[model samples]
Target: MSITPDKAQRIAALAKLAISPDQAIRLAAQMDDILGYMDTLNSLDTSGVEPMYTPVEHVSVLRPDVMRQDISRADLLRNAPETNGESFVVPRII
Candidate 1:
């Protein structure tokens, strides 16, 4: 399919693009070249080729979930700007 100036103008308008008349003519020719290349690619036959989903093989490494150390609440609350008896306090948002 070939792209004409009128078609290019309509495409630019639909895409909310502000292009000059000269730019529209150039864009039409560029679009035609792109469609021509796509047509050439469509002519290639790949009947037995396997489709690749990812470029490389991937494996998930699993690890056991276990706690190694314990932290005191006093140590955590020491850096807070304001804190209640057991938790940090902050300004309330509605």
Candidate 2:
């Protein structure tokens, strides 16, 4: 798999990237090398191998969900510039 500077420029444009002519040539060669490596990896036989759900096997440490009233709602809403008895007031939009 060989990549040309023209192909590199097209790839850069599609990715919304700005690259110089020299940079395009360099990137094209790098892309060709990567594709060649991918082709090598694809040739490996792994029909019996099971797919991984995650890289590492570990149980998640979760915290218990408990409701705690740290402060009153009236105290929190007191700082608002314009707030109704129940909630903060905002401009109506259609």
Candidate 3:
């Protein structure tokens, strides 16, 4: 899997990236190495291995939802610096 500078430039353009000619050349070589490694991995034998949905074991630690009494509006508004007996007052915006 040889990646040319032209191919690297095109890939960068598709990804909305700007790279110099020297950078493109460097990126092409790096991409080629990565693809070569992928090819090497593809040659492995895994006939007896079980298919995995995820790489790590996942456990849901969600706590049980418990209903509780709601606080009164007066109690909530008590800490407000400025209020109109219902809601907090702030400088008006345009």
Candidate 4:
């Protein structure tokens, strides 16, 4: 998982970041360490462990959907700038 300065430079280019040669050298070393640590973590066994999406428990706070007709279709159509006695007429984009 060793990171070379050239690889670091390429990584920086991909991220749209500009770095000097000295910065690239430093970045290579830092990235090497990070990758080494990730390799160590990957060596662990978690066969029986359950996968979790988040560390904390979460609950839905959304309101339930209900069907109700408050406004009539003719009333809604009357407010439109342009319509063929149906939906609002919008400018063609495609």
Candidate 5:
């Protein structure tokens, strides 16, 4: 799982990133260290441990969905400085 300079250069190219030769070498070393740490973690034993999805033990409480009266379009448009017949008018992006 070691990352070499050539592999790092290839990864940078594939990701469309511009990196110097010195940066490529440094990135490769860092990636190798990360992989080494992951490998070390993989060596740990967790045979009977229960997997935890969250730190706290509590059920999620959610309100039941119910329809409510909505505001009229004219009421909503009254506060806007600029708006179309059905929606707010915004500046063109492109």
Candidate 6:
């Protein structure tokens, strides 16, 4: 794809980047070159190739979830300044 200086200026504006006119012209050429390479890559056939998220072989190791004893309610409410018989008692937010 060809990238004009005007297109580069608009792209810079959209990206919130500051660039000079000369820099925009230079960058537009570079951007055009990169896009041309991408276009070349896009023309390659990969019909039988599998899509990969990562280059490396990954194994997600996870710990087994086991049922365990939970802390008693009385123990949990011990440190609270204001707690009812069941739960915490805070000032009404509404």
Candidate topping TM-score: 4
Instruction: List TM-score per model, in order.
Output: 0.45, 0.48, 0.48, 0.51, 0.44, 0.49
User: lDDT of all the models against the reference?
Assistant: 0.87, 0.90, 0.91, 0.90, 0.89, 0.91
Residue 81: error of model 6 in Å? 40
Worst 10 residues of 6 by lDDT: 53-62
Compose the digit string of candidate 5's lDDT tens values, residues 10-84. Answer: 999999998899999999999999888888867889889999878876777778898775988899899998998
* Count of clashes, each model: 0, 0, 0, 0, 0, 0
lDDT of 6 at 92: 100
- Tell me the spans in candidate 5 whose CA falls farther than 4 Å from its real position: 6-22, 66-94
Residue lDDT tens for model 3, 1-94:
5899999999999999999999999999999999988898678898999999887676867787997759988998999999999999999987
In terms of lDDT, which candidate is stronger, 4 or 6?
A: 6
lDDT of 2: 0.90
Writing each residue's lDDT as its tens digit, candidate 1 over 20-70 gives 889989999999998888898677898998989787676866688977658
Off by over 4 Å in 3: 46-53, 59-94
lDDT of 4 by residue, 1-94 (tens): 5799999999999999999999999999999998888887678898999998787676866777988899988899997899888788899979
Better of 2 and 6 by TM-score: 6
User: For candidate 1, what is the lDDT?
Assistant: 0.87
Candidate 6, residues 1-94: lDDT per residue as tens digits?
A: 5899999999999999989999999999999999988887678898999998787676777688987769888998999999986899999999
Error in Å for residue 69 of model 3: 20
Q: Candidate 6: where are CA atoms >4 Å away? A: 60-94
Q: Against the true structure, what is every candidate's RMSD?
A: 11.6, 9.2, 10.5, 10.4, 7.9, 11.7
Note the residue pairs that clash in candidate 5.
Answer: none
